[model samples]
Target: MQDLAFRFLVQLEPENASNFVSLSNLHASSGRWDSVAELRTRMKKKGIRKMPGCSWINVNDEVHSFYVADKSHKCTDIIYTVLDSLLLMMKGEIDVPGLGCMK
Candidate 1:
């Protein structure tokens, strides 16, 4: 199912802009930083500038907007910490025995 979805995503038009951006984000989430960089470069070459980074939070029926450069949100540190934890877990799982057993 995931494979089909991924293929469908990849088949999206190169001009969609968001498609490439989504692919880059997926790669980054899977620890493929180099692929993300390459995709970003491709997007730039195709004259598709990335949209400015922004986030929104809903609080008491109010939507608060936060930009990457905004000092009010520490998004960078939060993302780094999450990624660090994932990396540690991945390393530990890889070190486990019998998981990769080849009979």
Candidate 2:
């Protein structure tokens, strides 16, 4: 379905951010980092800006939303630190509870 949508979008417009991002994510998940980098670089050269990711959560009857790469938040440094640690840990052999060690 995504491939079909991507093809259709390509027919209409080949350089839109959403389609590029969707295809880039597909390539990234498949360990095609070179392709991802190429697409991003092409977008940069073409002056196409990718949309920032955003999500919302309800806390104490208030809805709070945050966007990716947003540095205005006070805990941004701490969040990035923990995220970096998790990425480093995941890069090594992980001991899964049921699946055992994954290379």
Candidate 3:
């Protein structure tokens, strides 16, 4: 009951750190260390996340790296399919649940 209510408060105002802190306290009270940790990580990310200045990839066991807005990958069009989906999060238009995958 309290969990749902607290989570709903977070949903209502995701940008408000107080809601997240309340949720984290709830997790801590239950000894849900992992949930508390994940929430803390989310808070840090929500506050400090930034656009990538570079990216890397592995193909055929070879590593390749690229700079911001790179267009050098042979599969750039296909790779960008993944990138486009992630732009909203990168722009901080939405809360990120976990790190996104880039090609």
Candidate 4:
């Protein structure tokens, strides 16, 4: 894998490159390399440039935002590691892999 960040499928706008990248990452994480290659091929044919991801938080009536591949935050790695750990724990409890709608 190309670093740990390549393991997640982040949300993206419809028909955007980030959407394809997200799907590709999802496939990679699930050991579906063929699907990842297919997604890349389609993206290449469509001339899509992978877009940066963005996330925001509302705290004390203030907004904090960040983008994928951004390195401005000092604690980004720690934050993500904690998140991954939490996700693993949740997955173990629920017997589910990957993010899916709860039912």
In model 1, what is the error at residue 26, expressed in angstroms? 1.2
Off by over 4 Å in 3: 48-103
- Which candidate would rank higher by lDDT, 1 or 3? 3
What lDDT tens digits, residue by residue, belong to model 2 across residues 1-103?
7756765775578768887888788789889899889878977888888778998878799876779878776677987897787786677644435545455
TM-score for each model: 0.43, 0.51, 0.45, 0.38
Q: TM-score winner among the candidates?
A: 2
Model 2 scores worst on lDDT over the 10 consecutive residues at 93-102
The TM-score, computed over Cα atoms with residue i paired to residue i, of candidate 2 is: 0.51
lDDT of 1 at 5: 61
Ranking by TM-score: 2, 3, 1, 4
Tens digit of lDDT per residue, candidate 1, span 1-103? Answer: 5434644765766666767777777888889899889888887888887567887879899887877666565466785677677786577743435645531
Candidate 1 matches the true fold with a TM-score of 0.43
Give me candidate 4's TM-score against the actual structure.
Answer: 0.38
- Output the number of the lDDT-best candidate: 3
Cα lDDT computed for each candidate against the true fold: 0.71, 0.77, 0.80, 0.70
